[model samples]
Each structure stands twice: as C-alpha cells, then as structure tokens.
Target: MTAGIDLGHPQAQAIQSDEDVVRVRQLVRTVAVAARLSLVDQTKLVTAASELARNTLVYGGGGVAEVTTVDNGRRRGIRIVFADDGPGIVDLDLALTDGYTTGGGLGLGLSGARRLVDEFDIVTGSGQGTRITVIKWSR
Candidate 1:
C-alpha cells in the first residue's frame, strides 16, 4: 500500500472487463480502509469507484484506474482517476444531467458518482476518450 504522504506514485489497475471493475472496487475499499475513513465514507467511495469503473468499461472502451492516498496535513483522503480511449462524450452537460444515458443505463453513474465524492473532475472530447478523477476525504 502506498503511504498517504507520498503523492508522487499512485497504484494503478487496468479496467478492461467486468472482473476488472470488481478489482477496482476492492482496491478502492482497501485504500479507503487504510486511510481510516469511516464506514459510511468508505462505502460512498467504493460505490463511486464501482460506478466509474463500470462507466470506464462500458462507455470508455476500457482504460486504467489510478488510486492514490492523499494527505493535506490535517486530513487524509483517497483519490481515483479513471481514463479510457473510447469515442468520447459529445455533450458533457447532457451526460451529467440526471436520467441521461447513451447506453440505456439508469443515467446515475456519472452524476451519482460525483455526488458521492468530495471532488470530481472530467476531461473528454470528440474521439479523445474520457478521464474522470474523484476524491473522498475522511471525516
């Protein structure tokens, strides 16, 4: 496990299939527990990770997820970055809105994941794929 104080190197896992998504969830849970996050916080982070991982596999056309432990002196947190080289999202706004999905899903993956984390960021363009980063801080 990487120390929270070290922000230079993060652990990464490839998200290529359903099994990969499960592995991502386990990795996130491990890191979250190691960070001494509350059970509720851990669950939130895990749920968010699972959603993002599935999105990476289903929509992003497979990618990698980087997990890192973070510390801001007084607080500790877990950060995850999901990146994939899919077709990319054409409408960011529409994608983020509730009840919107191109794959006939519940449309809660992106927006719901965002709500579960303390920080969220997304980068994507036409044919450029997508990258999403999220963080959960321990309370």
Candidate 2:
C-alpha cells in the first residue's frame, strides 16, 4: 500500500447546528481562495462542504469537521472531513446511489458532493455513526 503523505495540521469546526454549517461553508471558501483555486473549483468545494455539513447536523445529530491543507509533492489540495457519532448509515451502496435518501431530500447531496470533489471517502456502519472526507485539488 502506498503510504499517505503528511498533510499539515487541520483546523476544526463544530457542527452542532445549522449556524455551524454556514460557518463551515465560509471557512471552506476562505481556504479555497487562499489556496488560489479557480472560482469554479472554490464554489464546488464550498458547495460540497455545505451539503456534508448539513448531513452531519441533520442525520448525524451534529459532529465536527476538520479542514486541512494537503500537499502531495506535485499538487496542493484542501481536505475536509465531517465526522459524527450518531446512528450510521445502514446501506453504504444505497446511500451513494444517485437517488437514495432517507431524509426526504432530493437525494442529491451525497452523490452531488462526490461529483464536486476530486476525492471522497466515507466510513459508517449501522450504529457506528458516519464520517466523510473530501478533497479538491488546486488547478
């Protein structure tokens, strides 16, 4: 297995409520801008972060999101991880499907977020809560 590079220390934000989601988006946007990402890329990352943050608040019963600057020798990217301790997803495949939602939403949040970012990873079990990580590389 290829070893993961050491990304710099991450900045964390609490996601206990809707207000925290807004704060996350703002923080993501600021970091995206500071990284000199394109306007479109910045928006994509911010939008994805918003969706995941909301999921943490609504479905996960609140959580914490960690934001970090990543460098893989050749490229720089931003990685955001949303983690919660609430009940976890029951079906990983179904949850990632395009039109699957347990929250009466349009079912576009997770799939759409995956489309927006360059990398995505999720970990969850029936009662283990949920954790999602996404990254967008600078152009």
Candidate 3:
C-alpha cells in the first residue's frame, strides 16, 4: 500500500543540472527492477519518474522520490511520489498545459509524464511544497 525511497544529490543546486537528472533516472530504473516491474511497465515508470525528479530539482529546490507498489488481486502496479519543499507552482492549470514552461526546451514535464503513467497527481501551493505521484500498472 505504501513504499518510499530517499533520493540524494551532491548538492541541492545540482538538481537543475543534467547530471542530477541522469542520476535520478538511474535510481528510477533500479527501483523499478527491484519492484519487479515488467519491461513495458518499466519503460513508462522510468520516464514518469525521470520527469518528476527533474521537476523536483528544478522547481522544488530539492527533495526525495518515493515509489509505492499497489496490488489489487488481478492487477498490480507501482506509484511514484515526488515531494519537495520549494517554491510551488503558482498556476497549476498553466503548468499542466502543453508547451508551457518557464525554462528552456520543450516543456513536457507534466503532460509527457502523464502519458507515460497510468495515473498522475500533483499537489502544490505557493511556498508550501510539491508532491507528484504517478502510477503504472502491469499488463
């Protein structure tokens, strides 16, 4: 029902760097494998986790990511929760829209992440913090 993982970086500021993103991606893969996630499911989970991790570093200042495994009889799945206590998004609607971003490059953090996973939830408030959870089911 609930599972968690503690992600660390050399420095909080390093989160914005590509190197940090790579590190988080690696961690996501490892976690997926350890969770016994299927190949198809792994691909999606990893992508979603990567996107959420990048956002936490970029917008949330810095924090950790947690993956939860949920099994409901015939179906099994994993849920990823990215939490950070940084400056929160002021506009949730605008942030979820495609092609919207304050940073450079194609801003597909939310939409792209959503496409990769079965379910996605984001909670944030100004100066409060952010918690993004994405789930992928085994098929």
Candidate 4:
C-alpha cells in the first residue's frame, strides 16, 4: 500500500515451519532496527511478523514472506508481506473480529497484527489464497 520507494532488496524466506516464523521475526526486527524504529516499535513489528508468519504456515499451508525497508520520503519504515496459496479466508470480516478463531488458537493473529502496525492490507477470498501487507513507520 506504500507508494514509497523500496530502500533495499526484499529479504525473502519461506514460511513453512515454526523455525521459519522465528526467522521472520528476526528479519523483521533487523529491518525495524535499520529503519531507526524505537524499541517499542521494533517489538510491535516483530510480534506482528511472528503472528502473520504463523498464520501463513498453518492456515495457508505454508507460504513465503518478504521483509523490506521503505522510505516514504519523510520517514523510514519496515514493510512485511505474507502470502499463501492454501484455502483462503471465507469470512474476512469475522476473521478480523477480535476473539474469532477458526484454528483453535486465541484468534489474535490477524486482528492483533493489525493493531500493532501503522498500515495493514489484506487480499483474500474463499479460494483465492491470501496476501497480507503490513507496514510500521519510524516515528
């Protein structure tokens, strides 16, 4: 959703296992740091990345993520994209509602991640797969 220019090449990784989720968190943290995000902001972005990566692996049946740095001219930011080709969410409204869980977890993955980021965008459908993009700007 950012019209901003890419600051560097995206660092991509497959989201196929629990370990990959951890790696996502680390990569996001690295970018957040490089963007000069505050410590709190860094934690929020990394947490969001963890949840989204987990969702990509579980609900999406594995996928890929790209973590990149972006600059909207005024400030630097960290952008993360999570995509999957599994069964797409049928009810996006319900999926985003807090406490709604289709995977038996706490149901905080999607909604919580949205709250943690400065910008959130998701493209999904019943059989169209899912692509989620989140960005957190450095203040």
Candidate 5:
C-alpha cells in the first residue's frame, strides 16, 4: 500500500467457495472500470485478483477480499486486499517459486499475480495468516 494516497471505503467480498472467487473478479472489474483503467489493464487486474482470491480460498482456508478505489492526485486506480486467517506460509521463498506448490497446483498463483499487477504486497508468516494487496493504476 502506498502512503499518502486517498483510498475509498473498501467493499468486502468473501473468498470461501469457488463461487466467491468468481464474484471477486467481478468486484475488481467493476472497480477497475470506475477507475478508468484501460481494457488491457482491467483484464490484467482481474486475472491477478482471481489468482490471489483462489490462493486465499484454497491455501488460507477462506477469507475476505476488500476492493477499493484509490487516487494519488493525478491518477486513479483500483486496490484489492485479500486476507485470510488460516495457517500462514512457512517458506516465503519457496511459496513464491514458479513451480512449487504445497497443494499440487502449478505454483504460478503468487508469482503470476505479482507480474500482472502494478503493485503487490504480501504479508504472511508461520501462523500469521496471509494478506495480499494488489494495485492497478490507470494509464
């Protein structure tokens, strides 16, 4: 999260079921459109949101996604925070590796999501759960 930016009140969305993950994509797309993001940017943001939301659901044992619109004076953007209260990641480096997964997934979720968004922040530890924040700025 960037300091000094004005962020609107976040709209919370659940990340429990597979359906909830789909709804998170919709929520992000709506905010991305309102922020004046280009079509490509919007797609990228939505894809990132989907990946992160799934991680929250599968790995984090369900959580919430908070979608918000933000302004940094000149540009507008959408920011999403995915948080969960499950057991946190033990090895951050391995978790971020491109082909490593604790759940037999392809292991591209975190790394791929980082590449798709303009800004990405993740916080997790052994038992601290996980919180991932992604921001997509309008061009």
Candidate 6:
C-alpha cells in the first residue's frame, strides 16, 4: 500500500536497547558507511561512540546512543547522541577538562572523545540529566 503524509515531518530511528555498547558500535559503523566516511574517520567515530556508550553505562546507569547522518552539499557527517536518565554531572566545566575523573577513566573519555570528532556538545546538570552529542565529518 502507498503511504501519504503531510509535510514538515522528521524521520528518525531510536536504536535498540539490548547490548547498548555493541548496538552503538554497529550504528556508528552504519552511519559512517552511509556517509561515505574514510577509514580514519570511521575509526574515530567508533572510538568516540565507545567512550560515550561507556559513560552512559557507568555514570548514567544506562542509556542509549542515537546515530544520525547529516548531509550538506559536498560535505557529509555522522552525529551520535548519548542520553541517560541517571545521575547527572555535578560540574560540567571540571569534568570536561583533561585529567578529571569521577569514574575510573584517565578522565579522558569526554576530552578524548572530543578530540576524535569534529564537533562536541555535552549537556548535563545535577539531578537534571545528561545528553552528549558528537559529530565527525568526512573530508
């Protein structure tokens, strides 16, 4: 059957929940391929995805990473968003800076993930929640 819908609608996929880390990795890889990202870019994307997934599980108790592909003319990129409802970050500024750890990472997950990708946005507050989005473009 044919489907009809009005304009001004957005189509998005909310990734599966089971095996969060593995699921995230697969999604990132798919996005990278669809975006025509290079091997280097794919590696970086996967690395960043892993970091965010870990943070969500460890700090957020449990969360899911959403993967989306963005296209702009000759440029294309993949965006990965990690969201959690668990305890939020108390100090965002301190947490972002290198060598800051509440969990047992080199305190580098946030910073390292940022370095691997092109754009990074982290929104977290005490009792509020956390949603981190990172993007890497193919060039």
Which candidate number has the best lDDT? 4
Clashes of each: 0, 0, 0, 0, 0, 0
Candidate 2 residue-wise lDDT, 1-139, digit = tens: 1123547678899999889999999999988898788999999999999999999999999999998877777777898999999899998889889988999998888999999999999999999999998889888
Q: List, residue by residue over 94-126, the lDDT tens digit for candidate 1.
A: 999989999989999999999999999999999
Q: TM-score of every model?
A: 0.94, 0.94, 0.80, 0.98, 0.95, 0.84
Error of 5 at 62 (Å): 0.1
**Lowest summed-lDDT stretch of 10 residues in model 1?**
1-10
Q: What C-alpha lDDT do the candidate models reach, one value each?
A: 0.91, 0.90, 0.73, 0.93, 0.90, 0.77
Q: What is the lDDT of candidate 6?
A: 0.77
Worst 10 residues of 5 by lDDT: 1-10
| Clashing pairs in model 5, backbone N/Cα/C closer than 3 A | none
Pairs in clash, predicted candidate 2: none
Task: State how far residue 113 of model 3 sits from its true place (Å).
Answer: 0.2
Rank the models by lDDT, top first.
Answer: 4, 1, 5, 2, 6, 3
Off by over 4 Å in 5: none
For 1-139, candidate 6 gives per-residue lDDT tens digits of: 1122222222233333447677778778876887689999999999988888888888888867777777545567777778889789998888889999988779998888999998888888998779998778789
lDDT of 2 at 120: 94
TM-score of 6: 0.84
Prediction RMSDs, each to the true structure? 3.2, 1.6, 4.9, 0.7, 1.1, 6.4
Q: How would you encode candidate 5's per-residue C-alpha lDDT over 12-114 as one tens digit per residue?
A: 9998899999999999998888888999999999999999999999999999999988887878888889999999999998888898888878899999999
Better of 1 and 3 by lDDT: 1
Candidates 4 and 6 compared by lDDT, better number: 4
